[model samples]
Target: MTDIIEAIERVNGVLVDLSLEAFENDWQRQWLVERGVEIISEASRHLPDDLKARNPEIPWQKVAGIGNVLRHNYENIAAAVLWKLAQADLSTLEKACRSELAAEQSRGRR
Candidate 1:
Protein backbone atom coordinates (compact mmCIF):
# COMPACT_ATOMS: atom_id res chain seq x y z
CA MET A 1 0.00 0.00 0.00
CA THR A 2 2.84 2.33 0.87
CA ASP A 3 4.37 1.51 -2.50
CA ILE A 4 1.14 2.47 -4.21
CA ILE A 5 0.88 5.71 -2.25
CA GLU A 6 4.49 6.54 -3.02
CA ALA A 7 3.86 5.92 -6.70
CA ILE A 8 0.89 8.25 -6.66
CA GLU A 9 2.94 10.87 -4.82
CA ARG A 10 5.70 10.61 -7.40
CA VAL A 11 3.21 11.16 -10.21
CA ASN A 12 1.66 14.11 -8.36
CA GLY A 13 5.10 15.64 -7.89
CA VAL A 14 5.81 15.36 -11.61
CA LEU A 15 2.49 16.99 -12.45
CA VAL A 16 3.21 19.80 -10.00
CA ASP A 17 6.72 20.28 -11.31
CA LEU A 18 5.46 20.50 -14.84
CA SER A 19 2.77 22.97 -13.65
CA LEU A 20 -0.69 23.24 -15.19
CA GLU A 21 -0.23 25.87 -17.85
CA ALA A 22 3.21 24.66 -18.88
CA PHE A 23 1.91 21.15 -19.31
CA GLU A 24 -0.85 22.38 -21.53
CA ASN A 25 1.32 23.38 -24.47
CA ASP A 26 5.02 23.16 -23.73
CA TRP A 27 6.80 20.53 -25.76
CA GLN A 28 9.71 20.76 -23.29
CA ARG A 29 7.44 19.19 -20.70
CA GLN A 30 7.15 16.05 -22.85
CA TRP A 31 9.88 14.26 -20.95
CA LEU A 32 8.07 14.81 -17.69
CA VAL A 33 4.88 13.51 -19.26
CA GLU A 34 6.71 10.41 -20.49
CA ARG A 35 8.18 9.80 -17.05
CA GLY A 36 4.83 10.31 -15.39
CA VAL A 37 3.21 7.79 -17.70
CA GLU A 38 5.89 5.26 -16.84
CA ILE A 39 5.42 5.86 -13.14
CA ILE A 40 1.67 5.37 -13.38
CA SER A 41 2.10 2.19 -15.46
CA GLU A 42 4.52 0.74 -12.95
CA ALA A 43 2.13 1.55 -10.13
CA SER A 44 -0.73 -0.07 -11.96
CA ARG A 45 1.34 -3.23 -12.29
CA HIS A 46 1.45 -3.50 -8.51
CA LEU A 47 -2.26 -3.13 -7.89
CA PRO A 48 -4.05 -6.15 -6.49
CA ASP A 49 -6.24 -8.01 -8.93
CA ASP A 50 -9.11 -8.12 -6.49
CA LEU A 51 -9.00 -4.41 -5.95
CA LYS A 52 -8.90 -3.73 -9.67
CA ALA A 53 -11.63 -6.18 -10.53
CA ARG A 54 -14.04 -5.11 -7.84
CA ASN A 55 -13.55 -1.45 -8.53
CA PRO A 56 -13.98 -1.15 -12.27
CA GLU A 57 -14.35 2.59 -11.79
CA ILE A 58 -10.63 3.32 -11.96
CA PRO A 59 -8.93 4.35 -15.22
CA TRP A 60 -6.18 1.76 -15.16
CA GLN A 61 -6.30 1.34 -18.92
CA LYS A 62 -5.73 5.04 -19.47
CA VAL A 63 -2.63 4.96 -17.30
CA ALA A 64 -1.30 2.02 -19.31
CA GLY A 65 -2.29 3.78 -22.53
CA ILE A 66 -0.02 6.67 -21.63
CA GLY A 67 2.89 4.26 -21.46
CA ASN A 68 1.94 2.80 -24.81
CA VAL A 69 1.84 6.18 -26.46
CA LEU A 70 5.11 7.25 -24.91
CA ARG A 71 6.86 4.01 -25.74
CA HIS A 72 5.57 3.09 -29.16
CA ASN A 73 4.00 6.12 -30.77
CA TYR A 74 6.26 8.67 -29.23
CA GLU A 75 6.62 10.64 -32.41
CA ASN A 76 3.00 10.48 -33.42
CA ILE A 77 1.50 11.33 -30.08
CA ALA A 78 -0.31 14.65 -30.26
CA ALA A 79 0.42 17.45 -27.84
CA ALA A 80 -3.16 18.63 -27.96
CA VAL A 81 -4.44 15.18 -27.04
CA LEU A 82 -2.00 14.96 -24.17
CA TRP A 83 -3.02 18.40 -22.97
CA LYS A 84 -6.69 17.45 -23.09
CA LEU A 85 -5.98 14.30 -21.13
CA ALA A 86 -4.02 16.23 -18.54
CA GLN A 87 -6.82 18.70 -18.08
CA ALA A 88 -9.77 16.35 -18.28
CA ASP A 89 -8.49 13.05 -16.92
CA LEU A 90 -5.78 13.70 -14.35
CA SER A 91 -8.16 15.03 -11.72
CA THR A 92 -10.22 11.87 -11.86
CA LEU A 93 -7.10 9.73 -11.64
CA GLU A 94 -5.77 11.76 -8.72
CA LYS A 95 -9.01 11.39 -6.86
CA ALA A 96 -9.07 7.65 -7.44
CA CYS A 97 -5.54 7.31 -6.10
CA ARG A 98 -6.42 9.36 -3.03
CA SER A 99 -9.51 7.29 -2.44
CA GLU A 100 -7.51 4.08 -2.57
CA LEU A 101 -4.91 5.50 -0.22
CA ALA A 102 -7.60 6.57 2.21
CA ALA A 103 -9.13 3.12 2.14
CA GLU A 104 -5.77 1.56 2.88
CA GLN A 105 -5.25 3.88 5.80
CA SER A 106 -8.67 3.09 7.22
CA ARG A 107 -8.00 -0.63 6.93
CA GLY A 108 -4.73 -0.19 8.77
CA ARG A 109 -6.51 1.68 11.54
CA ARG A 110 -8.92 -1.20 11.96
Candidate 2:
Protein backbone atom coordinates (compact mmCIF):
# COMPACT_ATOMS: atom_id res chain seq x y z
CA MET A 1 0.00 0.00 0.00
CA THR A 2 2.76 2.39 0.87
CA ASP A 3 4.51 1.52 -2.36
CA ILE A 4 1.35 2.22 -4.30
CA ILE A 5 0.96 5.60 -2.63
CA GLU A 6 4.56 6.48 -3.33
CA ALA A 7 4.24 5.41 -6.94
CA ILE A 8 1.10 7.47 -7.37
CA GLU A 9 2.87 10.47 -5.87
CA ARG A 10 5.79 9.99 -8.21
CA VAL A 11 3.50 9.80 -11.21
CA ASN A 12 1.69 12.96 -10.14
CA GLY A 13 4.96 14.75 -9.69
CA VAL A 14 6.10 13.82 -13.18
CA LEU A 15 2.77 14.85 -14.63
CA VAL A 16 3.09 18.33 -13.13
CA ASP A 17 5.95 19.02 -15.53
CA LEU A 18 4.51 17.33 -18.59
CA SER A 19 2.67 18.94 -21.46
CA LEU A 20 1.78 18.11 -25.07
CA GLU A 21 4.75 20.22 -26.08
CA ALA A 22 6.96 17.70 -24.35
CA PHE A 23 6.49 15.32 -27.25
CA GLU A 24 8.63 17.59 -29.35
CA ASN A 25 11.53 17.14 -26.93
CA ASP A 26 13.17 13.74 -26.60
CA TRP A 27 14.42 14.24 -23.05
CA GLN A 28 11.02 15.21 -21.70
CA ARG A 29 9.43 12.25 -23.45
CA GLN A 30 11.90 9.85 -21.89
CA TRP A 31 12.13 11.32 -18.43
CA LEU A 32 8.53 12.41 -17.91
CA VAL A 33 6.14 10.42 -20.05
CA GLU A 34 8.04 7.14 -20.32
CA ARG A 35 9.39 7.13 -16.80
CA GLY A 36 6.03 8.09 -15.32
CA VAL A 37 4.37 5.15 -17.02
CA GLU A 38 7.11 2.88 -15.77
CA ILE A 39 6.53 4.00 -12.20
CA ILE A 40 2.79 3.51 -12.44
CA SER A 41 3.28 0.07 -13.94
CA GLU A 42 5.70 -1.05 -11.27
CA ALA A 43 3.46 0.28 -8.53
CA SER A 44 0.40 -1.37 -10.02
CA ARG A 45 2.23 -4.69 -9.90
CA HIS A 46 2.71 -4.37 -6.16
CA LEU A 47 -0.95 -3.76 -5.49
CA PRO A 48 -2.75 -6.56 -3.70
CA ASP A 49 -5.18 -8.47 -5.85
CA ASP A 50 -8.11 -7.62 -3.60
CA LEU A 51 -7.19 -3.97 -3.67
CA LYS A 52 -7.07 -4.04 -7.46
CA ALA A 53 -10.39 -5.89 -7.55
CA ARG A 54 -11.95 -3.19 -5.40
CA ASN A 55 -11.15 -0.58 -8.04
CA PRO A 56 -12.53 -2.18 -11.13
CA GLU A 57 -12.80 1.14 -12.89
CA ILE A 58 -9.04 1.32 -13.26
CA PRO A 59 -7.55 -0.69 -16.08
CA TRP A 60 -4.96 -2.34 -13.88
CA GLN A 61 -3.75 -4.74 -16.54
CA LYS A 62 -3.45 -1.99 -19.11
CA VAL A 63 -1.51 0.12 -16.65
CA ALA A 64 0.87 -2.76 -16.10
CA GLY A 65 1.05 -3.37 -19.82
CA ILE A 66 2.18 0.17 -20.46
CA GLY A 67 5.16 -0.53 -18.27
CA ASN A 68 5.90 -3.61 -20.31
CA VAL A 69 5.65 -1.72 -23.56
CA LEU A 70 7.86 1.05 -22.28
CA ARG A 71 10.43 -1.44 -21.17
CA HIS A 72 10.31 -3.76 -24.18
CA ASN A 73 8.74 -1.90 -27.05
CA TYR A 74 10.24 1.49 -26.56
CA GLU A 75 11.00 2.03 -30.21
CA ASN A 76 7.45 1.27 -31.24
CA ILE A 77 5.64 3.43 -28.73
CA ALA A 78 3.73 6.37 -30.15
CA ALA A 79 4.50 9.76 -28.72
CA ALA A 80 0.93 10.93 -29.24
CA VAL A 81 -0.47 8.08 -27.16
CA LEU A 82 2.07 8.63 -24.42
CA TRP A 83 1.25 12.30 -24.42
CA LYS A 84 -2.44 11.56 -24.11
CA LEU A 85 -1.83 9.19 -21.21
CA ALA A 86 0.31 11.68 -19.35
CA GLN A 87 -2.17 14.47 -19.91
CA ALA A 88 -5.43 12.64 -19.34
CA ASP A 89 -5.43 9.00 -18.19
CA LEU A 90 -3.12 9.47 -15.22
CA SER A 91 -5.53 11.77 -13.39
CA THR A 92 -8.09 9.03 -13.18
CA LEU A 93 -5.49 6.67 -11.78
CA GLU A 94 -4.28 9.27 -9.32
CA LYS A 95 -7.76 9.88 -8.05
CA ALA A 96 -8.29 6.19 -7.55
CA CYS A 97 -5.03 5.83 -5.66
CA ARG A 98 -5.79 8.77 -3.39
CA SER A 99 -9.26 7.47 -2.67
CA GLU A 100 -7.90 4.06 -1.75
CA LEU A 101 -5.21 5.53 0.45
CA ALA A 102 -7.77 7.61 2.30
CA ALA A 103 -9.95 4.59 2.78
CA GLU A 104 -7.04 2.58 4.10
CA GLN A 105 -6.07 5.28 6.55
CA SER A 106 -9.60 5.50 7.85
CA ARG A 107 -9.74 1.74 8.28
CA GLY A 108 -6.51 1.80 10.27
CA ARG A 109 -7.94 4.29 12.75
CA ARG A 110 -10.89 2.08 13.61
Candidate 3:
Protein backbone atom coordinates (compact mmCIF):
# COMPACT_ATOMS: atom_id res chain seq x y z
CA MET A 1 0.00 0.00 0.00
CA THR A 2 0.95 3.59 -0.45
CA ASP A 3 1.07 4.08 3.30
CA ILE A 4 3.76 1.44 3.70
CA ILE A 5 5.77 2.87 0.87
CA GLU A 6 5.48 6.34 2.34
CA ALA A 7 6.68 5.06 5.69
CA ILE A 8 9.67 3.37 4.09
CA GLU A 9 10.51 6.54 2.21
CA ARG A 10 10.33 8.54 5.39
CA VAL A 11 12.62 6.11 7.15
CA ASN A 12 15.07 6.16 4.25
CA GLY A 13 15.05 9.95 4.21
CA VAL A 14 15.89 10.14 7.86
CA LEU A 15 18.53 7.45 7.50
CA VAL A 16 20.09 9.44 4.73
CA ASP A 17 20.00 12.57 6.82
CA LEU A 18 21.60 10.79 9.72
CA SER A 19 24.31 9.33 7.53
CA LEU A 20 25.62 12.79 6.87
CA GLU A 21 28.78 13.90 8.70
CA ALA A 22 27.02 16.79 10.32
CA PHE A 23 24.85 14.31 12.18
CA GLU A 24 27.88 12.26 13.31
CA ASN A 25 29.39 14.81 15.67
CA ASP A 26 28.92 14.28 19.41
CA TRP A 27 26.75 17.37 19.62
CA GLN A 28 24.21 15.98 17.17
CA ARG A 29 24.63 12.19 17.21
CA GLN A 30 22.31 11.52 20.15
CA TRP A 31 19.54 13.62 18.61
CA LEU A 32 20.06 11.86 15.30
CA VAL A 33 20.04 8.48 17.00
CA GLU A 34 16.82 9.42 18.77
CA ARG A 35 15.32 10.48 15.48
CA GLY A 36 16.51 7.25 13.92
CA VAL A 37 14.86 5.30 16.72
CA GLU A 38 11.64 7.21 16.19
CA ILE A 39 11.68 6.50 12.47
CA ILE A 40 12.32 2.78 13.00
CA SER A 41 9.52 2.56 15.55
CA GLU A 42 7.06 4.26 13.21
CA ALA A 43 8.03 2.05 10.29
CA SER A 44 8.02 -1.13 12.35
CA ARG A 45 4.60 -0.32 13.78
CA HIS A 46 3.23 -0.33 10.24
CA LEU A 47 4.44 -3.84 9.53
CA PRO A 48 2.20 -6.76 10.42
CA ASP A 49 3.64 -9.57 12.50
CA ASP A 50 3.05 -12.12 9.80
CA LEU A 51 4.92 -10.06 7.28
CA LYS A 52 7.76 -9.51 9.69
CA ALA A 53 7.95 -13.20 10.44
CA ARG A 54 8.01 -14.12 6.78
CA ASN A 55 10.91 -11.77 6.30
CA PRO A 56 13.56 -12.97 8.68
CA GLU A 57 16.09 -10.74 7.01
CA ILE A 58 15.10 -7.86 9.23
CA PRO A 59 16.30 -7.56 12.79
CA TRP A 60 12.92 -6.72 14.29
CA GLN A 61 14.04 -7.01 17.88
CA LYS A 62 16.88 -4.58 17.37
CA VAL A 63 14.53 -2.18 15.66
CA ALA A 64 12.25 -2.27 18.68
CA GLY A 65 15.21 -2.06 21.03
CA ILE A 66 15.96 1.45 19.81
CA GLY A 67 12.70 2.71 21.19
CA ASN A 68 13.25 0.88 24.42
CA VAL A 69 16.66 2.44 24.81
CA LEU A 70 15.50 5.92 23.95
CA ARG A 71 12.43 5.71 26.14
CA HIS A 72 13.81 4.05 29.28
CA ASN A 73 17.57 4.39 29.40
CA TYR A 74 18.49 7.23 27.10
CA GLU A 75 20.61 8.96 29.72
CA ASN A 76 23.12 6.13 29.51
CA ILE A 77 22.91 5.44 25.80
CA ALA A 78 26.29 5.12 24.12
CA ALA A 79 27.40 6.95 21.00
CA ALA A 80 29.59 4.10 19.82
CA VAL A 81 26.64 1.77 19.98
CA LEU A 82 24.47 4.14 18.05
CA TRP A 83 27.20 4.66 15.50
CA LYS A 84 27.65 0.92 15.12
CA LEU A 85 23.93 0.49 14.59
CA ALA A 86 23.89 3.21 11.98
CA GLN A 87 26.83 1.68 10.19
CA ALA A 88 25.85 -1.95 10.54
CA ASP A 89 22.13 -2.35 10.84
CA LEU A 90 20.34 0.47 9.07
CA SER A 91 20.96 -0.78 5.54
CA THR A 92 19.67 -4.21 6.42
CA LEU A 93 16.57 -2.68 7.96
CA GLU A 94 15.98 -0.52 4.91
CA LYS A 95 16.32 -3.50 2.61
CA ALA A 96 13.98 -5.55 4.73
CA CYS A 97 11.38 -2.80 4.64
CA ARG A 98 11.54 -2.67 0.85
CA SER A 99 11.28 -6.43 0.62
CA GLU A 100 8.27 -6.52 2.91
CA LEU A 101 6.58 -3.80 0.90
CA ALA A 102 7.11 -5.79 -2.26
CA ALA A 103 5.77 -8.94 -0.68
CA GLU A 104 2.70 -7.09 0.58
CA GLN A 105 2.05 -5.72 -2.88
CA SER A 106 2.33 -9.19 -4.37
CA ARG A 107 -0.03 -10.59 -1.79
CA GLY A 108 -2.56 -7.90 -2.60
CA ARG A 109 -2.44 -8.76 -6.27
CA ARG A 110 -3.08 -12.39 -5.63
Q: Give Cα-based local distance difference scores for all models.
A: 0.66, 0.75, 0.64
Where is the poorest 10-residue window by lDDT in model 3? 1-10
lDDT of 1 by residue, 49-80 (tens): 87677557767777666777778778887766
Candidate 2: lDDT of 51? 81
Give candidate 1's TM-score: 0.71
**Which candidate has the top score in lDDT?**
2
- Candidate 1 local Cα displacement, residue 22, angstroms: 5.9
Between candidates 1 and 3, the one scoring higher on lDDT is: 1
Q: How does candidate 3 fare on TM-score?
A: 0.67
Task: Give one digit per residue, the lDDT tens place, for model 2 in 40-60.
Answer: 788788898998898899899
Deviation (Å) of 42 in candidate 3: 4.3
Ranking by lDDT: 2, 1, 3
TM-scores, one per candidate: 0.71, 0.81, 0.67
Please provide, for model 3 over 1-110, each residue's C-alpha lDDT reduced to its tens digit, 9 standing for 90 to 100. Answer: 24434544544555564644554465554565566566676667667788778778777777766677777788787666666666676667667667766876899999
